[model samples]
Target: MAKELEAGFTGSPVEKPEGMRKVASDTASAIKREANAVAIGVSDHPQAAGSLVLGIGAAAFGLGYLLGRSSVSTRTRYWR
Candidate 1:
């Protein structure tokens, strides 16, 4: 145990492989390209973008309200 402790661990630091780095770079480029495309689309059609956002918001709100009501009813049923 003492000898093992004295030698200690000596290893090279772990690093991301070249393949992973290339993959990450490619993914970032793709995301940037897509975002730029979306920006251009939204800029070209502001009214459509606004309506899309509002529709998403309304859908999210409705989902949340339904989930909340279902949970309340479930708890009351179990309590009785």
Candidate 2:
């Protein structure tokens, strides 16, 4: 047990890096493919995409405004 502990890892360091490189490349390619698909879909339906984006932006702005109004301190000061 002590000898094994002292020896630590027996595998080559290069193996770990090669596996990580393959994983990174696969993830990058998947993201690129999904992005291209979304771009093509948006281009095919520009009006729908624009409407959806506008609706989402408007909803976000309204939510922020309501939150800001609700958080204001409106207590009346006795001496001010």
Candidate 3:
């Protein structure tokens, strides 16, 4: 046990161990901010769901219009 203690004491001195505290605090604060963001997302779940549905509907309508136009063009060109 004495030899182990001596060995442990033989390590180099830290230049600034206090700097580690700042890093720990920064990490903790970032984690807290992310947690708050998740909470806000949960709170807005209903609105998000509605927006997703609206987005999908708009995309489908746009795709359908494009495809219909292409098909019409092909038919007309073939008839000519």
Candidate 4:
């Protein structure tokens, strides 16, 4: 195993290092554009409105749950 490993390490050719930085920069640019697009999409419509509604609803539910636990006859109090 040691002989085979030594032979493999001694025999391989080295690679060229050109354009690696350029590739990295290009990949970063693409990721930034995708993130901006997603941000714009999320900001743009009925889905955002729906998300707001859901947030409000969850908050209201939490508040109601907390208040309900502190009182007696929750259904009776809300009826009037």
Candidate 5:
């Protein structure tokens, strides 16, 4: 495992397949634009974002509370 790891770092860099560069670039740009749009939306509507986060938090807390109070199996002695 150690040898394999060392070889991976020291070995020649791998090359991407033909046309992969263009596809990768397009996908990355699309993701970047979407992320920027989301950021702008969040910034313009801070109240909306806050409400969304609060609602999600409340739901998670309620779920956790119920799970914690659930009656699961108890430990037992098996050895004889």
Candidate 6:
């Protein structure tokens, strides 16, 4: 194993396939388009955007609260 490691391995340079490159480019463009659309929608309806953000925040807080409560209860039960 030491001799093999000392010999050192040589490898050819890897090149990205044309089809893969095209697919990656397409995916990037699609993401950009979607982001632009969302920005436009948010700009058009500021109130809706604010509500959406608040709703997401509330949901995240509720999830965290539930998880924390469950973990605390589990710990107490184990200690008992």
Go through the candidates in order and give each one's C-alpha lDDT: 0.88, 0.89, 0.80, 0.79, 0.85, 0.86
C-alpha displacement of 71 in model 3, angstroms?
0.4
lDDT score, residue 73, model 4?
A: 60
Give the per-residue lDDT of model 6 (tens digit) for 3-23: 546455587448654798779
Q: Give lDDT tens digits, candidate 1, residues 1-80.
A: 44546475588548654797879978999999999999999999999999999999999999999999887844435455
RMSD values for the candidates in order, in angstroms, are: 11.1, 11.4, 8.9, 14.4, 11.7, 12.0
Q: What's the TM-score of each model vs. the native?
A: 0.69, 0.65, 0.37, 0.36, 0.52, 0.68
Query: Any runs in candidate 1 off by more than 4 Å, and if so which?
Result: 1-17, 74-80
lDDT of 4 by residue, 1-80 (tens): 45544444664347643598668878999999999987787678768868988999999999999888888564644455
Better of 3 and 6 by lDDT: 6
TM-score-better candidate, 2 vs 6: 6
TM-score, structure 1 vs. true: 0.69
Per-residue lDDT of candidate 5, residues 1-80 (tens digit): 34534434665448753597769978999999999999999999999999999999999999998898785657776998
Query: What RMSD does model 3 have?
Result: 8.9
Task: Name the lDDT value of residue 49 in candidate 3.
Answer: 63
Ranking the candidates on TM-score from highest down gives 1, 6, 2, 5, 3, 4
C-alpha-based local distance difference test score of model 2: 0.89
**Across residues 1-80, which tens digit of lDDT does each residue of candidate 2 receive?**
35535557776676444587889978999999999999999999999999999999999999999999999979967976
In the predicted model 4, the residue pairs found to clash are none
Select the stronger candidate by lDDT from 2 and 5.
Answer: 2
Q: Give each model's clash number.
A: 0, 0, 0, 0, 0, 0
- In model 3, how large is the Cα lDDT of residue 32? 100
Off by over 4 Å in 4: 1-18, 46-80
Ranked by TM-score, the better of candidates 4 and 5 is 5
